[model samples]
Target: MTVLVPGIEGRSACTEERLLIVGLGLIGGSLAAALRSSGFNGQIVACDPNADEVALGKEMGLIDSGGTELAELLENVSMAVLAVPVLAMESVMKTLAGSLSAAAPNVVITDVGSTKATVRECAEAVFGCVPSNMVLGHPIAGSEKSGVSAANPSLYLNHKVILTPEPDVLLDALVRVKTLWQACGAEVLQMSVERHDQVLARTSHLPHLLAFSLVDTLARQDERLDIFRYAAGGFRDFTRIAGSDPVMWRDIFIANRDAVLSSLDDFEAGLARLRQAIECGDSDALIATFDRASHARHYFDTLLNKTSYQAEYHMQPHGKVTYRVRPGGQAQGRLRVPGDKSMSHRSIMLGALAEGVTEVKGFLEGEDSLATLQAFREMGVAIEGPHQGRVTIHGVGMHGLKPPAGPLYVGNSGTAMRLFAGLLAGQAFDSELTGDESLTKRPMGRVADPLRLMGVAIDTAEGGRPPLKIHGGAALKGIDYDMPMASAQVKSCLLLAGMYAEGETRVREPAPTRDHTERMLNGFGYPVSREGDTCWLQGGGKLTAGTIDVPSDISSATFFLVAAAITPGADITLEHVGINPTRIGVINILTLMGADLTLENEREVGGEPVADIRIRYAPLNGIDIPVEQVPLAIDEFPALFIAAANARGTTRLRGAEELRVKESDRIQAMADGLATLGVEHTVVEDGIDIIGNGNDQVPSYGGGRIDSLGDHRIAMAFAIAALRAGDDIIIEDCANVATSFPDFVALVQRIGMSINVGGDNV
Candidate 1:
């Protein structure tokens, strides 16, 4: 009764031992053809009741042998593929079980059933229990045509095949089943039996049933021919699955009756609501429903990769997302924001330019920093991820990088383009840097002009704009240049180019900016000296790789710092925040405004001072922000403006003209938003003066829509304003928040802010 087969080593690697397909229909025939195409030279025996079907399969060479008896095929078969209809599978399973005994049992059986529960139950009944060798799987792919004649060899390519295995299923059996599906170009996924059935009922079974019913009902009409003839492409597409095999679908509906019925009831309830809306002529209700459905439809198309939308425009129809934020919530508990974006960008750049491997921790995974990481990868440098704020960059050393195949795209990162300009200028190969719409409009002439002055050939768009093209192999000589303004980005740019210049390059700034670049360069074993506002570095120096521990961005921490300072009874601690002297203007300004802010647990992390900043609710009195702190807190002004709006008396700020050329015109954008919220404000070219409501308890913060102008900080600032707003504030164009704080929405909601996405999900 027991049949023995050859062992694994006895067969060639290119061949399966023995495979028996129980049904020679479309699925079974396709499996045979796919296996043969994949170099499985094993014997493929098929069984079909129709003689003609078996003869056609043999003629097509889909199967080497054919028969109508399942008993004969079971002997010496290594695996059995049950591709039969649900009703016929029970008898076939019983026959296969009766043909095999426990003496030499090694065959692994699997089914390609659309539904799993019923077929698994039949297997258990025949074998006294579901066999450990049986693995239940369903391919989430199909075709309208049926039979061996219509079989396609590439039917399962790029399609998902889900397996529902029991807890005690044999591991070897599962592995073999997965390998077979993968060999046919199917991505196999595993889940529980109950979950698989429940998911398929909603996603697949219900849709098929609706298609069949709708097509059948329409065909019964008196004008059926005319209706179909005049039908548009949409109607034909909706009813396309109605042409599937009737018997197969009928069995699926019966076998999955419980889940299918539950889904049908839920769908019918929604359909009744739609019907009522039409009967009562509710225009507003109809529009709201259609809008929600349209959004979902577009999102689904994007998931399926069937849409023509660009990456930037994928989040919203017009690249805008409005967050409806309600007032009154105090920030509480300890939180650490994302890693410092500036440090993150520099780590990748310097690490790529250094010698040997450079391991980094506390790297920012935000979009802007990630864009810089991807740019280096576009060049010939090998870099590992920002996996949980850690990155491993295998350094290519100075003059070791290959020319990029095409233009390097740094999305929404001005720091990347400017710094890359200097770094690429030293390279012997030509390079071009481009960015998203926002970065392309930013002024890059500052970096380009300075590089050109150093005897480097550089070109830019009209008016010193982006798409910076750096000509290769230019002899460069270092020179001492006094920066027209204080910009850490511009200073770092020339410093990087100076590394390969003919002599020492010294950059003097009028005002101080973030010193992350200088500190990180030192950490990389590259020596430099700083005197007051001037920093000098020598040319022809090699950087040895080292570790970098980037602290949490103080710029991102400013939002929560302002949030707690403005809201009543609020107390929150920002842990491990960077307190660099150049970037601590926000801390100084908030403290000067009479906020109950304190720094504790101060220590250094990777050459930057970091501490847990604790802030409690305190009445804030406005004052003229020190002109010296302008460059230091430049990036935090958007959030700082909200704090100014809530403080008593008027807060005057000056000497911040540098904010104009950022991701957006920060001053004007914030001014427009504050005006909508009933805040009194005056905007000058270099500064803004806001007259607060004079009541710290309840400021005159009203509800209105604020456009972020594609700026991440602006969007987050208004979201925090809801803490003191009288009503809901809608902030638009907030999708760019990923450039800095990707977790802004989740973190704010966790801290008790009544935020809703599109008037839902409170």
Candidate 2:
């Protein structure tokens, strides 16, 4: 097996083999460090434009001879690996070609670039003759941070390295390159450069571009300063990508313009159709759309969990597991969902308040969901679940929730704490809300003030934090309140309380947030009306409980959506997705960007829409996203950011500043990840701005380490980012991703995105 030889005088055997890596960024630096930690005894020569990085590489013992000059570094190296930004790849490759010509030791040359076609073309054009020993490599790994200081030796272990070679390229050289990566603790795959570009455009480039553009657009909006103040979890999640590096992302967009632009077109079309559906109030059409999308989501979820449950469990006899039924003995088909904390809270709270017996199938059984269920139960609502994934909620009528016995413990769900505050405010109940340390630290005053205005009494810790003592049982009077900022949770809470108010409770916002509450309330026969930025929920309205079937969460579907879009020959079906218009911004945006997305099997589950989504590899293009769409797609920003990075042209996003106050500062996390991958981006107060030209621009994941900041969205978003990076991207504190999508990594890998665990190499 051929091994990379660094700082060796002449062609040597295995004992003297070494590899020289230039630029001690996330990618180059990570390779050097990983090689040593993996017990590669051969010498490692490292070079970087930054003297500090060179010195640090030496100090970290990642290389034997570290310097700033390529000529000096290449003199004794057998193979040279360029792990730099996409814009810098050509220059580095040219330098390597010159060095190879001088030494002429049959040395192999390779580069780590996110996009391959352009880089390969540039290499061939610049060198005049492509070397048979040359290969293009991309390792899908990284965190949301950059620089040599963050480098770890184990970064590349058990990660995927994609190698794209020309038709005439020597098989031996390909095997050699593969062997070298394997030695550094990586799993290798092969693909064509064109295929890589197209797939990445949808999965990585387009998402990043949209995120950067979204932040830029929001930051420039007149009402941004005010809107950001009121931003909450959903908004923060939608705009988190606004914090990425400007220059690097700009380069990526321009480099892969064709594919990105195409994706943008498709995404825009989906958004337009959704907007029209909402404007027309075509419930049937809207429900149909949502149904198809929702079913698709379920299919995706099943695919994601295929490895978890043994075949026997799925193929069990019908009577093997005891089934719970109501008094009538009418058994509904068993539908089980993984512990989706967000959907669980929504399902329990909404189901309890509906008019009739609302049977919930596949309710999440995590601590967070139990907290919500327990709280509802204390308020005279019977919740039978945490068994067989079926939750039976005895409807309490719109205004029938009785006063609870004691304070409600919300556990660790910020969602439960905030949403319950609103639900209780509308009822004649005296309730106190409490939670864990992390949840308590989050702000609650936003919901408290709105509820108070609607005639509810609430006392909380300073700054409107949790541990709230609520004095209810007061007659709520409807009041028109303009939301100070954009927040779906706060808006939803007020809307819920407004359902029992004396008159029409009106809520106006400078910017729109998710409207699931409004949509679901309407579905339950509540007369909720919307005009422009205002939503009116008529009080004293009775909610009729119909069979309400929840679709698979779109947020959960994002991992597979991107995986199918990015990994070639990967066409997976995501079934039973919730296609609620307010939650489909990612689908809308990606479709507008020209992704080859299709919806099928559209139908209604209960009152919600469900559908199957089929997304294939397609070209993507960049677009200027409107600020209004931000609130609609807030939960999907992480996946959207990956799409933007692969898009073409300058994709601008605006009116999003809520990214700062999430479980962690998502903006900062995204920025840190992009920088590690050598992608240039601009961080702004409200959002990020990305410039793209669709040329040769891929970033190396070398120099730095990234921190997830304890945010699940951030962790998953960065994991997707790693799929297209050249160097191993190490994500620290990634356990938090389980909070949302528990099996994100496994799901993506099953669809063919290269990923691994407990290792540094991609």
Candidate 3:
């Protein structure tokens, strides 16, 4: 069945296949043209009622054959594309079913119909049942022009093609359809059949309807001729779609009646508000509306261009971010970083799980915490504001969560995805958790394996990575689990699941991890007790709504602390930083290294200890790291490694195997960066050993290019290392620093650090 379909630019589609395209119009003809141009060598047989269009398609070499006869093309045809008008789809489907049933029993049928619900129903009526090979799709791309002459081979390039494949659709058929669209350079996306219909009705049908109505109304005016003659570009642009095929639009309106009407009602209500504003001369209302629209438009453009400020800001070619830092600058400032990220995430999750509304202050507005907030909103929680570090969560109670429409995408937050696995495991509906590239590469097995022991069915990607798909309603039973590693994320995940399991759940960590989850649970009125290294909680306990005030993150403050310690004449103060007893390994280790650090104005805030930390520059002396402090400062090791590189003697660290599984291998990452900077270091499987000349010796820490490997902590650590660098240090892929510290560059500049950030456009 293979046939050479001639194309433009001396190209030809070379796919050894056959396709029957019914309707030689814009959509069908363009698809045929695009397929050929995309090098899909296939037999393309086109059918149309109009003889002229058939002749033009053949003349254009867009098809191997063109005719009015449908049965002739049905033979040996494995797939058919029905691209006719909406109201004519049923009739076409009926004809195909009756004719192709005998000739090609396995032919896969698909349509480029804008509305899918009616087409699916029409298909069911005509064929007695919509066959499993039938896939419904719509290409969200077109022009006002119609007919074969308007066909363009590049029409679908970079456009969206949505497939509304039913659950029963054959997997092979769906893949084939997706492949064909992709061959034409269209980005194929999937959605439910009903969702497709509703989305198109609002985004497409109603807009066209408005265009036609506006044009028609203007045409009927008394001064119509003058209005048309003097109309500006805005008027013409707004009503451009009014020039589209009238019959096709008319059928679309009738087919998608309810959804279009609903959208129209909403639009009319908005219009009425605008009308009232004009009549009342409410300048404030008019300005507010325009401002909101303008702001939204700009935000959409940013998303479309993948240049949003919060995420992926400073992306470069090949997905790398380069940071240039000048050496020998002291850091001296009095400021606080964002709120503790761990506490911010728990505030949203616990608030959403509680029985009533919960108010939280000092929420980290960083991308990681915001990702968790967005995930809760996706699950039907009414959340308001992280406005200036304040968030209000309308709790849905422990069992009151609606299933998310799709997987919860917790971007760059391993903590969010890990904890959510346990929280979602007890739900009545299934849920899948996904994350950014960095998180997807990190290990999820630690959490998944333990949750499986609790009788939850969880599936991980290859090599124990995400997206983690957790099946719902497992009749989970509490287990006395001993953690293989000292990870707070894994411990929190199990503890959250314990809240819904039968009987009591206890988790024992070999070493102490962060107790934020345990303490936060207690704050939410859920009883949790800690005895030594084991934390236990009872099942069927409800979390009560409460206020949370998150202190500035000590992890973020670590960069500044190290910056001040390594640079001479440096005196910096960090205010309102969390100094949770179990999480102050950074302070303890720095003190042990003989850093000039002091904790001032220490007090308790929202059940967590907070303090103002002031650090003065002092010559550091490296020592063998106490293995007991590894778990306490596991996340801060990257920054600590920077301090060790500037210390007076050899710094040996061991028994910190957990550092290998973070956003990046912190041990290896620091080792590689230190090597590039001409620092002496030894990398082992568990820890790193570094020999330093100390700050007074003008140590041999010459700067060279270092790759951060998309690790935020590694990037910031190197940025701080520039203080002791003999030359300019260049760090790559530092954009991810925004995940925890969005204002790192600005704050560092305010203190005497010289940093230059370069993005893709730069």
Q: Write the per-residue lDDT of candidate 2 for residues 48-70, one digit (tens) a residue.
A: 88898888888888777778888
**Per-residue lDDT for 1-762 in model 1, tens only?**
222333233114326657888888989988888888887878888989887989999999999887887786667678888999987788998887777663126787889998899988898788877887788999888888999998888998889999999888877677777888887888889998888888899999999999999999999999999999999999999899999999999999999999999999989987998899899996534544554354335433533553212232234323345688887776887888889999999999999899978888888777778667767766657676557888888787998888876888777889989999999999999999998788899999889888989989998999999899999899899989999989999999999999999999999999989988889889888888899999989999999998888889999999999999888888989989999999999999999999999999999977789999999989888899999999999999999999999999899999999888899999999999999999999999999999876465564579888888879899999999988888888887776787788778878987789777652222
What does candidate 3's lDDT look like per residue over 568-657, in tens digits? Answer: 889999999999988999999999999999999999987899999999989889999999999999899999999998998999999988
Model number with the top lDDT: 3
Q: What are the lDDT figures for the candidates, one per model?
A: 0.85, 0.68, 0.86
Locate the minimum summed-lDDT window of 10 residues in model 2: 322-331
RMSD to the true structure for each prediction, in A, is: 23.9, 27.4, 7.5
State how far residue 13 of model 3 sits from its true place (Å).
6.7
- In model 1, pairs of residues that clash are none
Clashes of 2: 142
Candidate 2, residue 353: CA error in Å?
Answer: 3.1
- Taking all chains together, each candidate's TM-score versus the true structure is 0.61, 0.52, 0.74
Query: Positional deviation of 438 in candidate 3, in angstroms?
Result: 2.9
